[model samples]
Target: MRVLTSTLLVEAVTELSRGTRLVRAKEVLAWCDRNQVDCQGAGLKNQALWDADLEEAGGPHRLLKFKSGECKQSRVGWALIAHGAKAREAAAHLGWRELRWTGENWDWLGGEPPPPPRRPASREAPAQAAAVRG
Candidate 1:
């Protein structure tokens, strides 16, 4: 199985709808435990298993990114991408107060934009003197 890092998941979340994209880190771990897929087993439910600060999950690529906070969900915090809370980062950055969890199926929100800067008038023309001495 490919390692599931936040970076990769971030890209995945960008394209996938919240219904299909949201996968909590703990849920994944629990699934793995139920299936006995990894040798680490349920013991892998420790906090040190994740490293959100580095943009990579600790082991096997499972990771998460909470609201302006470090990964506390067993090192890998469970999360939903594009959800109101999760999408807040991107929405807020775009100056939008809210964003619908619609991935590719999104509509525009009335986000206020800053005004453009004004340039000062140039009183003098640019220097363009050419010498012709052949």
Candidate 2:
């Protein structure tokens, strides 16, 4: 049980995507497998989760535009990864949590919480960098 984070999701999609090409659901599932994450439950659902902006959901970039008959049965339709919804006012609906599509709805994925965000390595400590700047 590993809690999925937006940062990790972004990294996965970035690594999986080619220039101007969106990552497909299958490729993302493969990534989860290679990374040892728990996402297999998602495949049992009607809609596929994508790593794109939720704002894109109602816009022209909708991933559902490509669904097959098997995918067209759900009201959930599809969901944009939580990370993609984090920057907007509408984000309140998505929240920041360890979520997974459990074939029926979004719920806790149940794993250790994500690690704290890391800072880039610096030649000087923060106080030293500030002292030098001053």
Candidate 3:
């Protein structure tokens, strides 16, 4: 069983159209929520995953189904969101927001948290920096 890595998912998502990408992303969020511990039928033994995820590296879109009564991540050092540590959780931790957005170039999730986008220096701060430099 090949573990569906985020890298693979990202690549798949990149291949999809913006509208379709969001649809898949929404499914991912739903999958995570449904599989949450507090939710019913939430356990490795009872949980089910999408067939596409297991087969085609479905990424985000595609109808989901259980592959029997349980599922497991094929990759080593991997765990499901229900158990703890999931792709969605990792995405959130890396600063992904659930907005109705669709863009091929937009980053859905990054393996690591990215640096904050640069902002123009404020007037006072710029002056202070210049004084120090001079």
How would you encode candidate 3's per-residue C-alpha lDDT over 1-134 as one tens digit per residue?
23333444333344432333232433443444543411112345322232223333334433211111111321111223232234335434543332111323222232233334357868899789899999
Rank candidates, lDDT, best first.
Answer: 2, 1, 3
Top of the candidates by TM-score? 2
TM-score head-to-head 1 vs 2, winner: 2
Total residue pair clashes for candidate 1: 2
TM-score for all predictions? 0.27, 0.32, 0.21
Candidate 1 structure, TM-score to reference = 0.27
lDDT of 3: 0.33
Which of the two, 1 or 2, has more lDDT? 2
Candidate 2 on 16-128: residue-level lDDT in tens?
64432334446666676788655532544412234232324334432321221223341122223432333222222323223343344434333432333356988778879
Instruction: Show model 2 residue runs off by greater than 4 Å.
Output: 40-134
Better of 2 and 3 by TM-score: 2
Model 1 lDDT per residue over 51-108, tens place: 2213443333232333212123222223343364654455344333322223332122
Q: What is the lDDT of residue 18 in candidate 2?
A: 40
Worst window of 10 by summed lDDT in candidate 3:
62-71
Candidate 2, residue 60: Cα displacement in angstroms equals 19
